[model samples]
Target: MTPIRHNHSDGDAVLDAVRDCVLAVGVRRTTMTDVARRAGVSRMTLYRRWPDVRSLVGDLMTREWVAAATDAMPERRPGTLTRDLIADGLVAGVAAFRAHPLFHKIVDVDPELLLPYVLDRRGASQEALLALLADVLREGHADGSVRQGHVERQARALLLIVQSFALSLRTMTDADDTELNGDAFLAELRGILERTLTP
Candidate 1:
């Protein structure tokens, strides 16, 4: 897929508008006009860039996912353990998604909007996540910490694992559940990932 180019400030404003609008009124009710008004841009500007709300929202979601991944990326340091880096990155990524106001709002209010990406169709967000994980796994492989395997397959599996945690965490735990709180869950997830990737 070709990346859309926009002025950084304008693109941020547009994405921020979409996030706010989705959180405020749900995806189905968020119109291009609404986004334009919130972004302080005319509808024509949005129309020229994106054909409809779905396309615009797709870009918005991709931007958010990339930002979260980039922010969560681990710093490379000498003697750093690959599993530690993976665990830290996954924890940070999941935390970012959990902390996003629009994320929970979408899950609670308009889950169908996410079904296409979750089901058979792979979205740009998923592709970006796969690429990020692949790069990390490649580094681990070069360091002889990760098992030799298909990098793409490993990356996809990791993406699915993390995505499940990010999107369905509420379904997996309850307020009264003691064993599956955030920290405990992350610890277990880290252990699982460490085992999975170890040579």
Candidate 2:
């Protein structure tokens, strides 16, 4: 499949520059002038598109997150259980977040900027994720694989669980006594989802 592109022409370049800048010096220190210079666009052009670095970073995060979620979606099969499909998608989504080169940088360097999306009420990224999962749950309901319930509620619960796991990785213990590695954690999460969805 052709790769999904979030921005148009120079916008793409600008977001790329923003990503590079954020990774290099963090969100606080990345300047519009620096992004303009890196993107080979005039400062005036950058200003026309974004009023400040925070807005620019918000757009960048949205674009990157949409792309990541799109790429992480699992292929739907006729007889697949709803829980299994959601579990697979969650695993892929979490893996995408984990594998992103800038994820750790943002978490370690500019976590405050990300707190609104993860800690507080729903943000653009969270809304997008909920919509995606809602669609999946709706499909499962149509196919008789999902229980009869409020799809939005199910979607919200799924999103919260997956988001918690993804954002709380740094806080997870790595003690040898606890099996909290990627595979084990995902397996546990999958089982939990299965039980939650079972009717």
Candidate 3:
């Protein structure tokens, strides 16, 4: 695979294609050739850009997850507290992720694809979210609305909490039991985030 000589501008089309492919038939069944055919690009072109299906799917996940996180962020008003914004954003972010079709497809059909990210290493999307979180935490610190601490560390901790709720909350949720349903746990998450960020 000629990994270093591809055009980045073609990423949108490629990502869109891979997203459709994966959604139609989970990552395990998706092939590099399928992505190329869906993207209307040559197989050689795809090979030049991505070594395999997993890498292509990785980029697609990064794109879609970042979009969800960005959309979940509340607009900052003059009197809005930064910590409150963060708390709201974190809760909203988890909700968005849980609602994402791509996330659901991967979790339902290709959960093994996530094991490496969950147990072994952070993915590009996680790093992007962490940077976004750190920047917002810095803003909160500047406004005296968040607890003082290393921004990266705080972001990482918050991410750990978010990941649990976003990825695995359903496993413990009891839709038949109102006390432990998804919404209840989301409320708990919001409370935990607020307490963690309170100065």
Candidate 4:
């Protein structure tokens, strides 16, 4: 059995090192030794805290990504989900996706890194998004801007489209077509929602 090391600061330093390695070499290639060297710790120290790269990656996703998703949600306005989705929220989401180096590198090096977060539909990020959508939908319906009957389904559908686009964009090699025209997507989405959802 491997002996456990109980220094909180060392554990944090090792995780941070792992995150850096992930960005530099990606998840699959980032070994415990690499993280330990980067963190100025021993491999035994890292292994004591996290058994393997898989466990470390899973913790990183759950801790970092979940917090990011939850913290990034814009404040809800009851009658303005469409405006929020089209104008500020969607734009912010796109910008965030573009700016996230770790996310980009993960997909670039190993697309499967995205699988648990995207394809499975049960990741921390997805759950956070669903909760946000539910709140927005409830607000929209309460203010009579969104129709009540199909609120949940429509919200999920809208989220799915955005998620799909994001995933596709990550894998795209052509910048010309791959670049997200935020305004265009939002305009089209708003038009569809207005036509279908307005009473």
- Inter-residue clash pairs, candidate 2: none
Give the clash count for model 4: 0
Candidate 3 accuracy as lDDT:
0.89
Give residue 37's lDDT in candidate 2 (0 to 100). 97
Given candidate 4, what's the lDDT at residue 13?
72
**Residue range 141-176, candidate 3, lDDT tens digits:** 999999999999999999999999999998787657
What TM-score would each prediction reach against the true structure? 0.90, 0.89, 0.93, 0.67
lDDT tens per residue, model 1, 126-164: 897788778778878998988889999999988888888
Q: How are the candidates ranked when ordered by lDDT, highest leading?
A: 3, 1, 2, 4
- Tens digits of lDDT, candidate 4, 144-199: 76667665676677667666655664354355654364545545644654665564
Candidate with the greatest lDDT versus the true structure: 3
In the range 59-101, model 2's lDDT, one tens digit per residue, is 8888888788778767766666766787777777887887787
Q: What is the C-alpha lDDT of each candidate?
A: 0.82, 0.80, 0.89, 0.64
Candidate 3 C-alpha error for residue 138, in Å: 0.5
Name the candidate, 1 or 4, with the larger lDDT value.
1
Candidate scoring better on TM-score of 3 and 4: 3
Candidate 3 TM-score to native: 0.93
Off by over 4 Å in 2: 1-8, 177-181
